[model samples]
Target: MPTSKETSKTATFGVKNIGGINSTEISISPGVTVLTGKNATNRTSFLQAIMAVMGSDRASLKADADEGHVKLDLGDETYTRTLTQAGDTVRAEGDPYLDDPEVADLFAFLLETNEARQAVARGDDLREIIMRPVDTDSIKREIRRLEERKDDIDAELSTIESRQRDLTDLEQRRNSLREEIGEKREELAAKEEEIDQSSRDIEEGRKEQEQFEQKLKELQSTRSSLESIRNKIESQEASISSLKQERNQIQNEIDELPEVPAGDRDQIDAEIDQLRSERQALNSEISNLQSLIQYNEQRLEEEDYEIAQTLAEDTEGGPSDTVTDQLLDDDEGIVCWTCGSNVDRKQIEDTVSRLQDLRRDKAQKRSELKSKIDDIKSEKRAIEEKRNRRQQATRRLEKVEAELDERDSKITALKQERKELTETVETLETEVKELESEDFEGILSLHKEANQLEFEIDSLESDLESVTQEIEEIEELVAQEDTLRDQREQVEDELADKRTKIDQIEADSVEEFNEHMDAILEILEYGNLERIWIERVEKSVREGRKKVERTKFELHIVRTTENGAAYEDTIDHLSESEREVTGLIFALAGYLVHDLHRGVPFMLLDSLEAIDSDRIATLTDYFSDYVEYLVVALLPEDAQALDDSFDRVTSI
Candidate 1:
């Protein structure tokens, strides 16, 4: 190839000899230069020296005794590079002391092949080229957008599932409640029937009771008539006795009852005396019992005194009130002096109360003993009175009884008459009994009425049972309804929560996607990108078989044209030029997005040698005017053809 100088393009890089130049200093100008020399003649070494000086690549070098040094004129600044190979590594001096051992590793990346050389030699800026094709910014933005959409979809799916679950639960509860309601309705119907039957039974019982009452009245009237007959008979018999006694007494010479035999009287007197003696004994026994009871009472009083002393000693430092009052006021337990342990105030109060009960019991027993003594004395007086009455009656009875004996003979004859009358009365009583036995209408009615009442009560009981059963069913149904209502409320709450989550997800996704798209569009010099959407294929039916689905993206570009006309386009069918422009816009967008998002500052580009030279020139001018640092790989020829605007040139 001819020397690059013939093209008159400025060189992107320049070098000048410094301390390590061969006995001379040479300034490299801004133009292409050709270095022709045999291998191992310091040509490659010189290149390394220049790159090392510029703080660029240095991978191919061997250590020698001396340091190779050079100076470089990068368009903006000057750098002095010096290198000394130490075994497999080299030391470089450019910026500061690259003390990191790996600092000398630039040699590993040295351009060793034509491909590597051509890649670096191209003057096309890598940043520009990357910005030239499908914008990395747009791709990244689209990816983020899709991710956000996916998150939203996931949230929506969760909401749907939750709603479904809640709805299903509500439906199940409703079904259960309906079943319970059905049972309750059935029970209510039965209860209504039972109540009606109970009312009927009550009515029947009342009617039967009326019949029994009427029959009972008739029976009572019949019994009264029988009573009157018996009284009359008794009076008539007494009349007959009086007449018979008078006749018999007239015959007896004033017949006094033979004075009760002295022996008989004596025997009676003995019985009376014995009774009096027994009463005397009971009085003495009662007196002794009183004395014993008094002794027990005294003993109880002594016990009371002891208990009082014990209580006073035990509660000396405790509450001053009565035991019960202290218990009411003192919740914290008192210390028992006797046992040096905690004593519940309530327990002490209870003990005191028991002592009072004992006292009352002792008093009650004393009173009871006194009452018994009085009763014994009263009984003895009654016995004495009976004895006196017996003595008085003995005198009258001796005289009157004698007369009574004479009257008794008369009474015998009267009794015969009375017997005859009694026989007639017996005959009447038998007839009455026969009349009663005739199965009166009242008796028959009573039996019938009792039977009816019993039947009514039975029916009423059956109806009450049915009503109770119905009430139980209603209660169960009400419980079920309550449960269903609670479940419905819960379902509503769950659905509300799910909806909120879904809404939140949708909002978040939309915001993130918009932010990302805005960032990319700003970098591309395109107006707002409205949206990035993904379309998924679904439900393919072929050969009578349904097939699963897949998804693909359709990139949408929305921007205002240079003329201020709004335009929208799809990625499917674009001219070569349009595609290239679109790609470049996308790449620019990517870099801007990367910077915004804190990505790497450098851009590495490959394969831009296909553009025509005119197009390449325009792109170069555009890149030089726009972005920052760019590293491009290109064909050697393409590199040689770049205009004189490139900042720096280095073979790969």
Candidate 2:
């Protein structure tokens, strides 16, 4: 069960030309405040004034006034609202207590035409009213986002696990490279010692030997340069191959993207704009028709003396009797207030009724147009998404192609340099061979062995350096394993909660309604009434030629006969008082279920004349327990049965 928060602030309302009230001011405390008055004494109008300042557009402007204002002072804050007649509809301005008052209007404002109260009386779908505040589409979108995040996390964890499996092999390869480099250094030192001893032995031809050694050194340098060029060529080839593969993949993705015809989006946008314009025009026409109908109906019912006299004087060559008589006589034609032409009362009424029908028809047409516009907008969004994906793929493909071209050009240059270096090495080797007389051959062999040993050592050291860096990177990734797992667990829990949110709301609403209905029936003590409860049932419904299963709120009524026998009954058998009580209880259920009391402190009630004064007082008292401020409008006789301790306002 939900409980209302308590407050001690007093609410003061200042009103001018709103609803049926011309102007009024009232202040009520944060408890039960009863407005006691006869009909047309601005009791309901005062309630409307409170609603206007509370951020609701349902309040009406005075028929005779062009503007209205409502100001509310609660605690230390003052909120004001201005209503001005704008052609056909009332335009509201200024700040209010709430930015959006949808929940308040549906649940907290318990006026005569409240949807929750009327749904029960009309036997409409109760589940739809209870779940109106929950946005199922938004919930589904959130679920999709969470699921995508979880998928990404899973993929990252998989990569981390795979890298952990390679850790041991990398360590072993790094150790091997270090040992080979150490052995190669020792061999190079021994070969250098041999070269020094051999060079001393060739002291007799020392100059020739020195010249031959220099040529051999040039040949070794040329060979090293040639090897470097070959290695570069190999690397460039690998890079070019990888880039080509990537370019192909991106091209395939672009090819697979959904095809959206050219200019389709622009055409759809133009259509949606045209439809919106038509709908707006229809709305304006509907508002004008409604205002005209309301003004004319009020004039006819109240019989304004000034309007009647004007119409009487305008009737030329007709009865010159009293204006009241002329207006009252059904057989005589009176001047039309709108067109300034003689017209029968019945004929004018028929025209008004026809106008009302036209308004309804236009309203329905506007609704259909709105739905169509939404469909077209959705289509345009889908087309835009496809176009974006294709554009991204095309950009990636172009980048990969450019990179491949650069790599190919580098490989060509490297091959040409290698060809020139190879020729230079051959020429250097020929010169060294020619300088090699049979006298200093041993010294030359020692030098060549030393050069080979040094190259091997350098290669081994480079391999060792690369292996060590990879080991460090793998260790870093392994450190984050625990943190990634924890995040995955948290996401899984959140996903589960979001998935079942709607189901929980539906169950809670049913339970709340049933429990409260039983308690209220006991308190009211209707002799034959046994119980009135709502059951959540599952059934298949037809939706656009498809049968889908849905959950519905089923209302049940039970009554006991005079012979002490209980039987099930339909809602049609319920009396007016019983129906009214049931409807109010349903509204109360929604209020608690939606937790409206936490935000909207004030609850307004009116038009409870169907229920007796005693029951009405009990209902009011029951409702007061759930809200900080409870305001009810009742007649003088009905107000007598309420608690004397409650604050009462007899005049506006």
Candidate 3:
């Protein structure tokens, strides 16, 4: 015999009644075979019997049978199971259950109610109804991400190492530069020391020079005054010679005039001696004044040189930017350099005026000294004439004895006056010699200034070199810092690329889920559904209260009205007849899959009255022809609606 191709052909499965029927058997076959009986017949009881055989323990048959059992046979295998008030037990032997676990599993799945079937089919977790493979691509992608992370870390480590090397090099360079700077500083210090010594020597030299200049000025001033005095002395000597010649001429004339005038000559000599004494005293006073004037002029020259040397010693850089000319130009408004205070122009003017007055006083004193000298000469002349007159009178009177005594007294006074004059001239000459001496003061001062400046320059240069070296080192570090930043940016960019790849992989995984959903829709012939989706509902917000509802899946469809308007509706809102048709279709598909896979060729169904009585038997016949095996629950009227082809239906 040819192997039956029909899904319901050549399979024997057994059923047991646990509630209404204690024991019963219903045979399943292909082709239309109707079950016909009265209204109260146990056709529904028989359907529950089949459910008990399939592994559903919830189905309770109304039979008085003491026990329930189901036996099934495929050509190459047989299976059996039993049910009781407590539970169901399944056993199979010599069947293809080992080849397909899905087949054995389908038997249990088919026994569920339409609601339960819908729930399982639409569930997000469909492990019970489907097989899923491990996501190898995701694993590989994760591994790739880890590997990329490791690579990035390795790159960072390299960058850090390079930076460390750069730092080391920079540090070494910094140290070297510092060492060089130190050596330069030491050299500069030595140079500064040399310059200091030179400056000290210069300062001492300046001091000596100042002394020399001062002494030389004094000597020059004294020499000038002495020469002037010597000129005056020459003039005095000439006058004295002229007076002597005149006196000699007068004496010759007198000698020619009278020999008898010895007494008179004696008297005249006495009076002339007295006049000479007075002239000598005046000459002495004049000589003293000249000496004082000469001394003062010498002192002024010494002071000028001393002040010059002192200024040079204190001089800063050759000459101050401030000039004597500027000071003199603004003498009327001169200010002190050191204190920024005004010099009081009146004070300076007064000082200048006083200096001029002192010069004028010196000139006056010289004139007065000259006048005194002239007066002394005049006295000498007068004395000579008086001597002449006295000699003439005495010689005539014979009082020559008295004239001799008077002449001796006059001689004594003249000798005293001559002594004072000689003393004054000698003092003036000594002062001139002293002023002419050479001494000076500015060399040492310049040396000291140079030394101080050199020291400061050395110190500043040392600090500058050190700072420059430090700046160079800092610049190197800055370069290294820039490199590090660039490396970090590159690493970040790489990481971003990796993250983008990861996102792409995740998107692909979601695509796979969508593809799997399409496949499920195709298998269910549910292409007309408005939307079908699966989710684990976290929360359902309704009527202003958050009601948490965990629904695994949902199927939504749009129904069309007779007026041709379409409206979205859920399976729960469908008419009973439509639900029945949907449920039947679902059962038919499941049974076909199970049968094709060599599972027990059986279906267990209940609650079929939603279809009209006329359509009832037709549905039964359709199931019987469409499937290899089926067990349907119905009233006798429903069974009568089936055609007469259905046979061997066991009544409870």
Candidate 4:
């Protein structure tokens, strides 16, 4: 058996799928070979077929087929993956690609894989994923130990600083507060002197204001009573006018009611209903008579047929035999079957004639019943017309009656309102009589005096409020000045201490691990991300248990230009090719870190759609030399540019 390196030269994947693929075998032999086809011609499905045989669980078998299966044939040995029970049952034999760390890292690198796409966009995720393929457990443990030690130092410093808090500015703040207190004391004394003078002036003003207010009150009472009497007189006049107008309307309505000729509407309605009942009875009788006529006529026809059959028998038979069959029994009555004692041919014919007459009478009676039904129908129509006219007259009368009732109601309401107006007018006249005898000159003079005192009192109250607020502010400042000064000094000292500790940890083991990743990117020649690195920084909290932002480290992508090292700060600025190349470089670096060891190890990528054709060709040529088995799926145009870089190529 050859080693994996030799066996990897030519590989074939055979698949019998329950889904997109028919039974087919595809071979990828030595060097770059593109599986080219229009979309969904089993191109991607074939690639997935290879993945499935290599222990990739991403085999989407054909829908509703008995069983789906994939086989990987390396000249030395074969690996198989079968999905049974219509793809519901998955059975795999041979090693999963993930069992090999290098293979696992390569699997993670596949752009079709979710893990690779996620790691490429986020810095922390990329850092962990790239490092996953590298042997860095010892370095990681050392970094963890150092971080724990640094945390301990920081914790001890916090406890000591909290216990022995420094307040260097306290003395200065205390002296300043003393000066402020003295100034506020002088301000308070000046305000008190002004308040005392205003109090004496207000006392004299209050006594004068009281006498004026009492005089104004008595005069206002007289004015109120006069206004009320005037308002009532106006309301009463309006009421009298409205009442007269309503009474005239009621008289007009009573004079205009129209007279209608009286008719017994109920009797007409009863007659119309009776006509309808009679019509229904006529129809029922006609239907029964028609049925009887039809039945009897059918029986008459059958009897005539029987008599013709008897006549035919008589014509064929001997006369004597025929006559004997027609005769009655020996002990019969004298007028048997309407025949006399000496039975003759005429008597037999009369029996047949009587039946014919009876049938004719039945038909005549049916015709009579039909005529009666039509007459009843006509009567019903006439009665319905009369009933409609009576209904219209009744509606008109009801409308006229409703109008008369409304007019009568208005007349009664108007009379009641006129009586109320007369009473109101009498009460108003009595009230106006008493208010006609008061003097208002003295009240006018009192109002002017009260207004002047009110102005002076408002000015005094405003000044008192200002002085009271000033005193309260001065006392608060004196109380808080020392505490604020102590807090400021302590915060400044702690911030300075933290800065020193931050400087001390810059050259630690974490930075060294980052240096190794930087070298990997350089090897992969990630042009867009030359100095890309993750940074650790402190975060702020609201004095609670520490809660970090989504991640502790920030992913910084830096691009170097001629001027200096330019920064590509955000993922958005990178082009599609640049971004994909960054992920590709990471996966390749991981592949080398773990060292390739799986049988027929190869790389798979389904995401060349975003990269330009030139870049795709260049990357294809570049990757071909590094791996023995490189199977790429590309569109026709991109595969055309592949040229001699591919050993052999086939389309689906």
Candidate 5:
């Protein structure tokens, strides 16, 4: 049991003779609560009653019962919906809690739609249907999918770019290696004759060349190691510098943020909510009054026209005195045929005056309504502005709070990173400094030894070159040239192949239809046509916006213009009529751009006059992509548009 105040806050429900349900009453909690029962135990029936209270006509009486009733108690108000098989209609009475007609549509798309239910039952993600990035979540999802594909292409392009860079570096290294090998071979050839001049000299020169080669390898290795260490030291120093800069920036940002204080958020929210409810009530009243005024004006116009026409006909047929006599004799009084009301001669005489007075009264009432609406609007506006001010303050405070949190987190991260970098920089700098100081003497000694070895080698090579020119045979040089040609051919082939691959990768950038050529084949992945989102990615360009030749479209989807062809695509898979309908959707999307978050549009078609009935079903399905409420006056027998894809089909 709850206190009266707490009890009155809950919604209660009662159901009787609905489907297999007999009589049951339940107090629904404020939040999500489940009702468990075995199949065939009226669980669905009870649930249907709850849906009914929200304006879903999903309930019917049991076959044996003549009538069914669902009663809902929302706080202090109660509403009842009576279901009768005789009339095949749901008649709602009392306070159904739904004063606004708009709310009735809320649960309709979710609760009553079997397709939607099946989709959910299959465990499909509902975000695609619920997100407001666009009125149609499908469109947004399609765009997201297109982005994924574009990213995949970009990944491939990145690989190609990286490979190209590698190829360029390899090509340069290959050229340098060939140059070094060629120079060494030329020097050896030049010394060949001198080596043949004496066996002792030849043997001594061979030993000297071997030793020089060994020392050269050692020197090269030492240099490479030194360079590696220096690069590491430099990299650490750069990282430390960057860390310090970033830390300073973050600290500055943290210092700039203002401190925030607590506010009376709950009270402010309550006031705003109360003001909004009052405004909603005022809006409903104003809408009702406007509707009444419109209806009254139309009725008056029709009444006056009919009365004038009837009076003319009556006057032409009979005298005024005779007509008056006939009216007096009648029990129902003068049958004012025009207005369909009882009126005497006096009433007829004052007909214009009466209409004028009634119009004046209605106009005055409308003015008063407008004035009242203005007052309510002013009040609501003031409340909203204050609420917005508070909300802005709250947002600013939250932003500052979040910034502070981020600042703390980032500061901690920066401090740890800075410490690690500082340690690394210190260690590398010490090693580099010690190595530099200690290696100066060793490097100088090695340089002197290297110069002496080079002087001896040069003298030996010079003597060998002169002797070789005089006595060496051409056969050896010819054989060496052949070997070098084969090696050069092999190197050239590798370099050429790499260059070709790089070119191929660059060419892959222009493959406009490579990924999207199969979009039409892929479009058949989802549902029948009543509601759908069609996506087409025509082409994607990876390059930044520049003066480059690329396909005009990046991502394209089905589009329609009003009564126009549906596609701007060069490759349209749908038929001409389909494209036309799709074009109409584009037109609708453009027209309803302002009301995108309001859900689907309301469209009226005067029989879709130019369209043929053979493609009505297709059009119906296509229309669902754009229109929520479509009023198309078409001959059903001819149309047959209400196919199995449609949820409900009614004929009059």
Candidate 6:
């Protein structure tokens, strides 16, 4: 139930050309507001006007007007709805209280024709009506999407875990590389010292060895250039190999992606457009059927025989009797409003009943068509996603291949350079050997050892740099492990919610309906009615070629006999008042279960004359406790039964 704080504000409505009302404005405060009038006083029209501003397309335009408008002022927020005739349909526009009013329409509106109320009266599938707002297919699709995301996250975490296992090995390798580099640096320094000593020795022992010393210096410089060229060649070779491997991996990914057909997209789009057009046609047919049924029902219930009398008078050799007299005589039959022929009232009712059934069937078909369109749209989205992924992979593959080609060219150039450097080194060595003598042998050997030590130091430093980079990369991956696990947990939570959402709504609905039904039944005090409850029962049903188990809500009615013995009874045995109360309670259960009072603020009731005036008063009072606004249309006598403190709108 809503609190007083939630219902303290008043709402004002301005309506024009909606339902039977031409134009009117009214202000209603929170709690019970009764619309007291006889039939044809636009009581229902006022309710329709409220519905229009509340974002329901079921509101009808006035028969004489091409456009209708409604405005609702609640608190400081104002909502408006504009209805304009377009071809055979009325299009609604402008901002309203809600963007989508499906839940409110089902649970909060509470009109006589509301599906939830009518479903109980007609003994239709209660579960289907209650679960209509819940899109199981959409829920399943979301679950699948979340599951896929979780799977991807899990795979990445698995890779991260594997990298973490290599962390220790990478650290050890980094330490070893550092030590090796340090040793090589020390050896290179020692060798340089030895070369310096040898050079001093040569300078002191042989003053004429200066020309040989200059040749040896040139040889060592040439050898250093050769070593640098060889290093460049090795680096280029490694880069080319890595780029080729990347290109191959990208190529494989591209190959694995499914190919999108050239014309499939266009064909699917065309089909979807066709389906939408068909759906629109079905909507029009359903609307027309509903209007027809409503008109006929009013004719029957209100005894408005003007049209039927006119038709009967127009027929040749028509009965020279009053239409009222004809209607009162069941044997002679009443004039058929559609054809001017005399037909039984029951026959006309049977036709109307058939029309109602047809409307329901078409409504079901429309729902199915909507689902089909959604399915096709989902398929289109999947196709577009796949095409996007393929395009991205192809672009990446092209870039990698281009890079590989450039590296290959660079490698070829380096190889040529290395060859030239090698030849020059050989020539320099030969020159040094030719200039060699016994006195300079020690100096030459020291220079050779120093060059070897320098090469070894460069190699060790490169290895250390490689090992350090690997360790840093592993550490970064390890850092992402926590984030990945958090993401997986979030996805799992969402997945669980999606998977269990329908079941929870079902269980809650059943529980709410049962609890409210018991209380209302007790309050209404149906003497024979001992209890009324709903059971969630499971049964197997055939779906196309497959058999599946489904849950259904079974309504149970317990009654006491004259002998004071209680027995179970079917819904068929319930009286008119009992049925209407049950329907209203069912709607209330839906209202509470969906928490419509929190958003809708109003519950509208009409055509509830089956229940007695005292019961109507009790019912309205009981319902007023739940919502901010409870507006009910009742006769003047019924209104008298209500509390005097309740607001009464006697005129539109």
Candidate number with greatest lDDT: 6
Q: lDDT of all predictions, in order shown?
A: 0.41, 0.82, 0.47, 0.51, 0.43, 0.84
Residue 74 accuracy (lDDT) in model 3: 54
What are the models' TM-scores? 0.22, 0.85, 0.31, 0.37, 0.23, 0.91
State the weakest 10-residue window (summed lDDT) of model 5.
Answer: 107-116
Q: Is candidate 2 or candidate 5 better by lDDT?
A: 2
| Model 2 score (lDDT) | 0.82
List model 6 lDDT by residue over 1-652, tens digit each.
2223445789999999977788999999988899999876788888878888888877878767999999988777788999887766678898888777888888988877788888887888899988988888889889989999999999999988898889899889888888887887888888888877777766465655776778777878877777877788788788878887888887888788877996999999998999999999999998778667755665555444565666656663575586545655454366765666777778878888899899989999999999999999999999999889999999998888888788888878878887887887788788778878887778788888888888787777787888789889888988998999999999999998998899999999999999888888888899989998999999999999999999999899999999999999988998989989999999999998877877778899998889999899889988988988999999898899999999999999
Error of 2 at 457 (Å): 4.3
Q: What is the C-alpha lDDT profile of model 4 across 562-600, one tens digit per residue?
A: 767675767667666666765665555455444442343
Off by over 4 Å in 6: 1-7, 62-69, 82-95, 203-208, 305-345, 560-566
**Greater-lDDT candidate between 4 and 6:** 6
Per candidate, the number of residue pairs that clash is: 19, 0, 56, 2, 10, 0
lDDT of 5 by residue, 1-652 (tens): 1122423245667888765567878765432222332223444455556555544443445545777788877556566777655443334444443344232232122221222222232333222222212222233334444555545545554554555445545545545545554565565554543333432333343434454434444554444344344444544555556655655655555445433222444455555566566656554444344333322322332233334445645666744655555544554344454565556544543554454345445544544444454445545555565656655655655555565565556556655655665565456544433443231334334443444444445444544554444323333443354555555455455545544542332233223122222232244221222222333223444666644433221223443556644655331444444333433333233223323224222233322324455455544554454444443434445345445434221311
Q: What is the lDDT of residue 314 in candidate 6?
A: 69
Kindly list the per-residue Cα lDDT of model 1 for residues 166-199, writing each as its tens digit. 5545545545555555555555456545544543
Give the higher-lDDT candidate: 1 or 3: 3
Tens digit per residue, CA lDDT, model 3, 336-436: 33343446556644554454345445544544444454555555555566667657754543343344345445445545555555565466545534433
For model 3 the local lDDT of residue 383 reads 59
lDDT for model 5 comes to 0.43
Candidate 5 off by > 4 Å: 1-231, 242-279, 286-652
Across 494-547, the per-residue lDDT of candidate 2 in tens digits comes to 889889888888998889888889999999999899999999889999999999
Which is the leading candidate under TM-score? Answer: 6
Candidate 6: 10-residue stretch with minimal lDDT: 1-10
Q: How close is candidate 2 to the true structure, as a TM-score?
A: 0.85
